[model samples]
Target chain A: MTLERAVAPAQRAVDILGGDVSESALKGYLEGLPGVDAVGLEQRAAGLGTRSIKTSSKAWALDRIIELIDLTTLEGADTPGKVRSLVAKALVPDASDLTTPRVAAVCVYGDMVPHAVEALGAAHGDPDQGLVSVAAVATAFPSGRASRAVKLADTRDAVAAGADEIDMVIDRGAFLSGRWGQVFDEIVAVKDACRKADGGYAHLKVILETGELNTYDNVRRASVLAILAGGDFIKTSTGKVSPAATLPVTLLMLETVRDWHRWTGEKIGVKPAGGIRTSKDAIKYLVTVAETLGEEWLVPHLFRYGASSLLNDVLLQRQKLTTGRYSGPSYVTID
Target chain B: MTRLTVPKTYKLYLGGKFPRSESGRTYEVATPAGEFLANASLASRKDARDAVVAARGATGGWAGATAYNRGQVLYRVAEVLEGRHAQFVDEIVAQEGVSRAAATAQVDEAIDRWVWYAGWCDKYAQVAGNANPVAGPYFNISAPEPTGVVAVIAPQDSSLLGLVSAVAPALVTGNTVVVVASERFPLSAISLGEVLATSDVPGGVVNVLTGSPAEIAPWLASHQDVDALDLVGAGELDWPALEQAAAESVTRVSWPEQGPDAATPSIERIRAFTETKTVWHTKSLL
Candidate 1:
């Protein structure tokens, strides 16, 4: 499908939002979104980070954390074997402990989606019981520097190659340069390209690359713009930036989604990717979501962590809680 | 005109930094004659747990360092001790009610003990390891490796010398230590922390906590992350209960010797916190 065929749904969102869908109108809508209080946001995030969840509650959080993880491997050297191993890990995070929950998805680059899909299919004999989605990072991935047509084709290729979800990065340059319409149109076009022949569309997570956006104001603005442009999920970063997925940034994004739901009655998902490596950190993010939004956002459909090493730490901690003994990294796979 | 003397606050040394106890509790330490010395930070169980975490974090890098480098680091500790010799003597004299000469001798002996361990760092592995000859076409060897994090209870008496004796062996073998300083006399131990921080020793390699061993020993003995416990300072406390608690994790426990020989430096102290791994590989002609 081309960009023209995908215009109707986006045009409806623009129409409902009471805007002309022009650059100035889109800019005004984003700018009029509430600004973030930097110090207050950080203090609240840090305060919530100290809320201790122990024992049974911790165990429950670990299981939910595993289920909400987008187990990602986005290196240039990813191969079929690597993707297969990652898929196996995603399917049975702890082979020794059968009660472990399967992850939400096996995320990979666009070219590796087929391998992940095939591996997941072979492992999950009962599709309903162990259904793991495959997510591909498209739209030039970590860099989002490609032309619109190429980015659209990237999204289309992944969806055609068995990707149940497409993670597209927004043009940070355009978003920062006040070109709100271009950024919004790119997301709408990518969301359109996720369309399948059977009228089903892949879930779209728009990456705002909050690290490069420079301010909490821009992060809040981008969150509203992505939601208005029809993002199924608003992701914090591409895992390639330095200050990716910080607590305050995720808190701001969570508040944005909460307010957006309140205003439009449409619930969008939030995924904070990168630098979240420990079970404690994952639980903190979960606490933020539950406290900022409600218990409804604690499910896999509403929240996710785009992490790779986080699984091993979570597994190690979970095993410790189960066996009543400390575990080392040797017991877990190092992928 | 009189000049006011500024006294020091004895704080816990955790991960090579002086931090007040998270519990924000402090207790007063007095000389044997009941003269006031200084207020010491009364470390809590949480402080002990944090020290273990710091010690565990430093174990990998400390153990991976070359034996020569560890030797150099230990020697650096001795050098720093010598530089602070006068302060240690003064504190020892004030805390222990000993003669100034006896205090000086204790300070010197503590410094020499560090030198002794410094020399043994590169040599203990050879003394403790062996090459076993098997009746098969294989090469078999057993070598000692540092057993992760260790928790120590510094002796109640012989504060400076005893503290050095318990801490040096574990650290020279590349194992990180969380030591509960002598309950009655903790000032010298905190001063030693100043010496250690100035030395080349890495942060978390040797953490000193000033508090009751009875209060903190149970936590360290049962801590899942601690690999071993040296109950040299248990004194009149119940040893069997600590041993039983330590059994939860199968932590290696070493009790202090009852006689004068407890002050002696030996490779046995070093071996108490090391694991000997023997490997066999088939020798074949290709």
Candidate 2:
């Protein structure tokens, strides 16, 4: 093989990688590139086959889809059976061959917080280890249609039951009606209630229910409104809307959180919920947070996917990579 | 004569009450002089949310106010800050750990930056914006509107100047801001916050939080409520990643060129805070 032939393959490889180059064309292009060195061309061909830019793009898209499961699973409507199944799987030990993205939290109804706590407790102590410790539909959650007093009490109850975090929904009805003050006051009361419990308190994640909010512009405004309303984290969708946790919505929230952190010297968290169900989907969100907020929020503390059942796929992928052998679904432990 | 000694602690500037960090978490503030000035709040993520609620509760009339009223309110802030010029000098000096003279210069620039932004409240739309020439004849013009809530990372070195420069533009354009001044110089930012509160600029419009940038910025960056982000003071950020995360919602990001002096600021900085929209409504013959 000649040097000119060797160089030709790399040239063809670059062309095939550009845009919509078909697979066969890419193969043909790789074969023809005049890379004079046979071993080098073969190595290059393998590298191109496995390490394409599209692979990273695909990984990112996968991450976002994985994130949707949590975004779409509304706690108020979740059955006890569903919660138990999630808890059992989350508590699975990491030492096993089963690979799982630690369930960030098992969001449940306020009435269900104790059940989740008990289930998580039975699995193990160290609240965050075996479980993420979540209480959803917080003070006026699902609907901010309650009195401030009632909502505050709701928050208090959830936190007292060992909920490490509270996912509270804002009154989008009031917000859309331009009653910003009412919406603001409701969030404040809930935040105060969270603090009164346990000396300081559980993380308060404000669910904007963006689908109801309407408009990207409104979503942006609501995001700012929720954060300023004392939300420790701002999440999209209660998983009950027609359009729950879109990529654009999560991205906007991430940007808002980033800007807020810079100006105030305070850290906030972001969770994208609804419809996520693949390893590929989870990675997109990881990439989104990684790109938007830096590497700091890559962990469960600041970044989480409100998911269910997506772990199996994530595990399967991790397993495949480690052993270089595809395994049966049962071989990977989801629970 | 005993030498005057400086105190070494920062209290939470909440509702005019200067309380110790409620979380009891404290971190050191390093000055340009290569010394630790004081131990300030390592505000937890919870504290940040608390501040947001405060800001949100206060945004009703703050953002809904008539432009004229809003301008007047902002102008009053500049006046109040002017009246307390000496206090700012003292705070900036201690926070930045600079000589009184240099601190005075920085303070003057910071104060002036507010005045500059204050003036923009009444006229920014006319300058950076205009009526668009449309092909189909209908009154068509695009103007800039506030993007609602904004989060800022004030500059690290110029403390007061950088903080003022980043903050003023955001608020002046009617966007409520949650600012994180340099952890190295919270006193000045807090002092500025005090002046704004007294100036009647509204409570949550400009909530100030202080802690570690590395810890807090990612949270803010990824936060869902924040509409836009200003990185003027973000020294070395991973732009690609930051933009990627922001791309999810296409959050507006401002990466303006760094101003000359650490403390000297500019009007161009406000460009990061505004957006232009041209709405077209067409009526067809029945």
Candidate 3:
């Protein structure tokens, strides 16, 4: 076809032989084409997945998302001393010296907020210089299957121990059981508990564990529910499930936050966790927030990433910006 | 002969049982039949709150149901209404003082309208939208999704038809509805619930509460749990007051228009229930 020859002169020979060829057969024939980037092909073959991303002229924003590495784990119990020490060490990188800043935050079990506070404090030398404040998941935490009394108590203890922010999981079981009132009451109660903490309140973040909610609409609804329940933040997962922090789920969450802010004049935050390890993965979230909610939410309080391995990639990109090439990086130490 | 007369009572409908309004209060819903069809309970602000809780609790699983399943469930709503068509006709005939034939037609139209919306459940996404045109290299698309936990005030006069018309669009999009049907025509609305109950539509997906709109609308409007509202049937509402109340949580208020011709609602009526999202995607070359 003249059209094919005009578009891709190199493929003119194939066009001469294949004017009537079907696309599928052509695809098979073209499989043998040389110099095709397999990664590009793989990405193309992955199918259309829906999500929103913010546009930017500065490559640094993209670089920041695609390259920054974060080290975070919500596994196991946490202690005040252990968490504090980890915070201290992560702030000071040795050797490999990944030149980027440390991860956004160190997420831990609720009871370890005090330890995280101490660790973050000691690491910074001055309280304000630390890499991250503790993200203490509370309100019966991972399971979210407990009495309101127990959940509220958990939230109280976490915030009292100095959690910079508290992550509370909704009772999906209750939500699924058609007990929205109970779910609403529990979220509201926990948020109230977070506000009543000893040294003022830590930010209340509600984790919907969207994987369990099944559909995007449910996730959106849960986002609205969490924000209405007074959550300062709505998060994607507890990282205890299969299929965590997906693009579709995050897209729905971003829409909810944008819509909630439109309706209520309040800005609720979004935090995506579980399995986001690459700089590319982090950038997707940044782009998502920027485009969907507008550029105002690019900061940590409004937007955060629940990642452990993403910081180094961010550093790699940042270093490339300062120098000209991606260089050797170090694992930032964490107390 | 012990005066052989009985006092009427109204109650709350919860989990399929009618108990005294949790607030233990009753208000009058006088019928043109010169009798009360059970003195409807004055559902207190507390009771409205309870109903919201019930609907919210039921929303997750109901929303998770497959579109096909939801469609079938909605079709069953029509089927149930068909069987009880006479009851709805009688209520409409009495309340609106329309001819029996007209009442029957209204009931028939209400049932058919539900079926129309039912088919839309699996198909609106295709019609409303598909994907984004991203200017950078990435994958994307946008779909019309349900805004969960909608609060509806059913049209006052066209009780059965208006109630179904308001609720069908919301549910078809996968959102759960908590409705405050016409206070005067609560009978047919409650009767519709019977249809919803037997039709296999999940409980709480369509909750019908009978109470004073002025009294309960404020609670529903201001409550954070309610995502959007239909003020369509709010007759004599203090607009500024309702507006202020709706402002609290920014509940989407679709102000009631002039009573819809129950015979035919335009496509725009149906389209109003839908949302549009435009996505723009492009590849980045470094």
- DockQ versus reference, model 3: 0.00
Instruction: After superposing candidate 1 on the true structure, give the runs of residues whose Cα lies further than 4 Å from its correct spot.
Output: A1-12, A17-19, A50-60, A94-100, A122-131, A315-335, B3-5, B33-36, B131-142, B235-238, B244-250, B277-286
The regions of model 3 sitting more than 4 angstroms off are A1-335, B1-10, B14-19, B134-139, B260-267, B270-286
Q: How does chain A of every candidate compare to the true chain A by TM-score?
A: 0.95, 0.72, 0.73
The candidate scoring highest on TM-score is 1
Best by DockQ: 1
Please report, as a value between 0 and 1, the fraction of native contacts recovered by candidate 1. Answer: 0.17
Where model 2 places Cα greater than 4 Å from the true spot, the runs are A1-335, B1-9, B13-22, B30-36, B56-60, B135-137, B237-240, B256-259, B262-267, B280-286
True contacts kept of each: 0.17, 0.00, 0.00
Each prediction's Cα lDDT score? 0.87, 0.64, 0.66
What TM-score number comes out for model 3?
A: 0.47
Question: Whole-model lDDT for model 3 versus the true structure?
Answer: 0.66
Given the true complex, what DockQ would model 2 score? 0.01
Please give, as one word, the docking class of candidate 3: incorrect
Candidate 1 structure, TM-score to reference: 0.89
* Models ranked on lDDT: 1, 3, 2
Q: Whole-model lDDT for model 2 versus the true structure? A: 0.64
Question: Residue B17 in candidate 1 has what lDDT?
Answer: 95
Q: What is the lDDT of residue B198 in candidate 1?
A: 88
